[model samples]
Target: MNNISVIMIAHNKKEIIKSQIEQLSSIHNISMDSITIVDNHSSDNLCDFLVSQSRLNYIICDDKIENYSLILNTCISEFVNTQNDILILDPDSFLLPETLKKLSCALNPDNGIYAVCPQNILDISNDIHSFSAALNYVNNNDVSKINLFKIIKPEINTILLSHKLLSEHTLFDSEIISDELCLTDFCINNILNDQFTYMADNVYQYYIGNHNSYYSPTNRNCDLAYIRQKWHMNYINTIPSSNLISMINEPIDKELNVLEIGCDCGATLLAIQALYPNSTLYGIEINPISAEIASHIASVKTANIEESVDLWNDIKFDYILFGDVLEHLRNPSKVIHNCRHILKKKGKIISSIPNLMHFTVLHELINGSFHYTDTGLLDKTHIHFFTYNEIIRMYEENDFNVINTIASNVTPMLSKKDSEFIDALTKLSSHKNDMLFKAFQYITLAEIKDT
Candidate 1:
């Protein structure tokens, strides 16, 4: 891959963004033009600074879509379609002079490997200074005697993604929605278990305590809940994605029309491609970058009702999907009402919405720490929140009869620290299964009612 693109998503990191950009531009392995900054509507001087740096490709989200996974996925959607190799890094992380060269040397592009991870990650937030200075210290005569590339444990600091993962349409899930956790999931679940990983002997130092993070502490903790819910009870691989596959009771053995809303990179559609090879697929996404990528898989229209409704016209559909999308809308009920006009006689509305009454939310409420976040169920962009009953009621009100309802990403499935937290809660409650079933998202399959 001749083209190398570096995507750094940051908001309000005024001090760190510039330094990170400088460190990146200094990389001899990649050109400065390849560096792209994703500014999430930062109030900091990041936007103005980015404007001055004409060589950098910076996408300023005027819409203020704050979902972390959505932001990352948007960048991936833009570049993954090309032959360019992608490097995703934390904005405050400093790369050594030999960092990119070592990583590039370790990667085997022809083997369908998606990423090569860093071997030694020196988290020098306590003493992190200039990249050149850190490199100088590492290269010091006395320090050079020590092995700098001996770490065996994998990390989420920096990941170099190959075109193979993009060709497969794999990206960070907008639903899971945490930067560190998402990278960890992509590395552990998608890459490490397979032969798709290349562990490079390079070091990266993260600079912290320098500027404000885009996310608040509460937001970070809330996102951690999702990571917890995913691995809950060690049920990792089964972490529900679109829930379309689980909720679709009827078969699509015949020629049918299927539509997916908020289909970031058309991931779910890509997964079940073999099942509905004959079916005509359509996608409605809010992010333009993701919409472009989804276009390759299906007929795509950018959404929020106003844009896509005109594009969809009066055409009816067999299935209209909403995978973790309803919450982000200003008026979810109205959107559902409008979607009714395009539903075929037997068409089904399939959706996976985060549960506002999740066990973690309940715990947060009890602890008095619930807050909106850049990601997770309480995503800042989410105007409408739903519980299990609310979702069922929404369908019933929209001329649809719920046929199948399944709980996904349940608290009992998480294998991490929160799983223990869930266990403690479950033990105290008399309603054990009921408490355990307060899933992260509720998946529903509703059939259209006769008018």
Candidate 2:
């Protein structure tokens, strides 16, 4: 086993830091001297607590240095030459006994694995609060079972990074500002160099802090913009659309042909392939850069959906998916009409369209202000808007029979204040419903009418 040095950052989290150090001290093959705590000038007498502990290494940062990426880079630079590996741990996260062993097994430096992270229970849900609570919860459950490992960009919570990789290259892009984005940029650079990052499914970690607040709104947005500028494409387009995925009713093992219009970076298509492994996937993305990325996973064509009808003349698909694509079309009805020719006789169409009747849009209209944002219900590129009924009507009018309508609500269950407003609106209007205010998008399934 190679020597692994641990680095943790502290910012006013005295109790969490105490728990972190206790957990770190219990891990096998790790000594008290190997852990370095960089205190970001905590006011909770955390430094005083650290001073009492003998054999522990600690550094007190000046109050002026607030950037997390910069602090982490400084620590990595100092330890890169001496340590065989470095483990960056979050202050509020607790690792299980087997986490390091699992992560070490996955991080085969001979196979060019640059970084590996344990599966975080907090990533699955937000119900668990602290280390003790999480430990109690997992104790009652089985821990031997494991899921398949995933290849993903590294997040800064509990990743074990290779010292060799860090020494040969820059540790983190301090310009990214946030630890997550900084590490993600480093992981991407490693990937481009034929190295990889893996998520160890069998290893488990529990996170309790509000990690979302690690980056300020301004800095996060700027970091995202910097990443977008560097990647030469919109980063958000790479996220798979769950609304559309939930509407897919096909058998998981069935062999079929799937086509996604406005597929962006083919994330949705790749997700479909994951579910329906025998399915042949295709994508129609307008952005050439996104299409190029999509091409690696699916048969992608870089062309506008309306003008590319003849592009698939030689092919027919079992399922045609429109994942928030219709509203962006200049003539959505014409495009839907044209899709009939390329669809199989009994083919179904699944679409996830933003609901214009959502409360947020209604609230903006009530205030006499209708503005377009970069993305959302009133995205600047959207040429048409539709309510749930209108979306169903569009397909029915296009000679298709509506099969199902699944509402995807971003808002939580209505609160008393929300219910009261909805009740008042229901008394004044016939078009009002509780779902209308709750559902941000509607996923509709349609099949061509038998002639």
Best by lDDT: 2
RMSD of each: 15.6, 3.5
What is candidate 1's local distance difference test score?
0.66
Find the number of clashing residue pairs for candidate 1. 8
Model 1: per-residue lDDT, tens digit, 144-205?
A: 22212111113445677776666665667676555655665565445323434445433444
TM-score of each: 0.46, 0.83
Q: Write the per-residue lDDT of candidate 2 for residues 69-119, one digit (tens) a residue.
A: 887877766643465688888887778777776676667678677688877
Q: Local distance difference test, per candidate? A: 0.66, 0.76
Model 2 — which ten-residue stretch has the worst lDDT? 147-156
lDDT of 2: 0.76
